[model samples]
Target: MAPRRYCRARLGGQSRWFLDRGDHLLDLQSAVDGDDVPALLRHLADTDVTWAPPGGAVQVDPARVEWQVPVPRPGKVICLGLNYAAHAAEGGNAPPEYPALFLRAATSLIAHDAPLIRPRASDRLDFEAELAVVIGRRARHLDAAQALSAVAGYACFNDGTLRDYQRRTSQWTVGKNFDGTGAFGPWLVPAADLPPGATGLSIESRLNGQVMQRDNTGHMMVSVTQALVLLSEVFTLEPGDVIAMGTPAGVGYARTPPVFMKAGDRIEVEIEGLGVLANTVEDET
Candidate 1:
């Protein structure tokens, strides 16, 4: 099988696009829009569409349209726990004995620019800026060196979470998977173009233009490759699946005087090369 080309764009008055397989030799166009890009993909996984070459210079309206989560329907949203050393320490925890891991159900994902709702059950909602790796191929027990090769691309994901709920449970699942908590991407750039080192990529989060969380991916306790390798060993990693590499410290939950998200708050997550994802907070009714 050749590398698959996945794209999300506005089509037919909705945010949607076609996935082309190598120069349009094969393709699948779908109308699934809003925040269900991934569902459209799974619907046409087995079909192939005829690709048409660009007839002329293609034009687009960036402002009038929007891009969504590359995999609007990922089967599993795998996440790294305590991958960031600083983040772990902030929680009064030591580095992971091994790669701490977890998964966020797909329903928690919201497309770019979607409103991040603050759950009525929790008052300490927070944002975790992370680099998300989109898996490209099925793999199990992959080696560290082969991990990057399995990646299709990378995107900026804001792991919106509720701190109080998360701490109440031994497992981080409930608090981390609140509706509209996962906001990522305006676009998913291919991994081939991403930075090669574990460092140099700057990740930051800002609330109302005030800087909140800032760090380099290099500080991760487990590098991206390491996390992939470890995860693949546990299960068959499928294409379009995502791995949120974990957020650095500075979460509202751990601040000296805890800060939480409220209605009217505008949070922005930015990764150096990748574009920023901005979303507003809306209180749950």
Candidate 2:
């Protein structure tokens, strides 16, 4: 059976869910307001969702809708920072003994194809490509062996950063939580579709059509299972909550002649099996 993929979208102010069908969207739910994660979580528990629904698949053209963040309003948008040894070294820091984690506000996220807003406060917008893990159900205190079961799926993410604000304080929250800077989702591929923890997958990022970062998920210092286990020990990971696996080396701020994104720049993050997430930068008016 083919793997399942989903896209949460908005059309004319109504939220809807769609299963990805070849070249079209198979409408999976009636139009509703607010998030669409609860329904999916229920369906996920019952079956694999590998077959098309009975009503001949109510399909729509891809262009008819606007994409929304995979988990539109995550209860927690926890992120792993400096989770790659090489990425840590690039910033003149040694590998961490524990995962460097941070929280990102939902306001910071933009959907695939949406314009990534470069705030007026800074022209130092930077991109960090990453893999996002979506929690499947409520989980707490899970050990490493049980961690993979807590994951619902995976998506591509661009952890857009503002360099100056990031350095102004010891905490990275301010810079990382700027509205509309984070880019997430084109689609979410079910965990059953890929290797466990999505390991060994090739992940890459591009700026204005030029490859800027490239690496494999296997190289992460803290693997997906480890991150989940570690996180669940402290707090519960509920359905639709997201965890952004840290980016690999080659970020703009670390380059020889620091490169940053400006208005009209395009950025894309792609991961094997998961779809590509692309966005164009626009200045805050």
Q: Pick the candidate with the highest TM-score.
A: 2
Q: Where does model 2 exceed 4 Å of error?
A: 30-34, 45-47
Candidate 2 per-residue lDDT, tens place, 12-88, comes to 67777788887999876543223658767656544445545555557789999999887877889999999888899
User: Estimated TM-score per prediction?
Assistant: 0.84, 0.95
Off by over 4 Å in 1: 1-7, 18-52
lDDT of 1 by residue, 1-285 (tens): 332344575555665554433333111242344355444434333334333434522334455445566776787789888878888999899997897777898888987788899988887888899988877777789897777777767778999988878888788888889888889775565565556533568999999999999999988888888887888878899877888999999988889888888999999999876767889999888
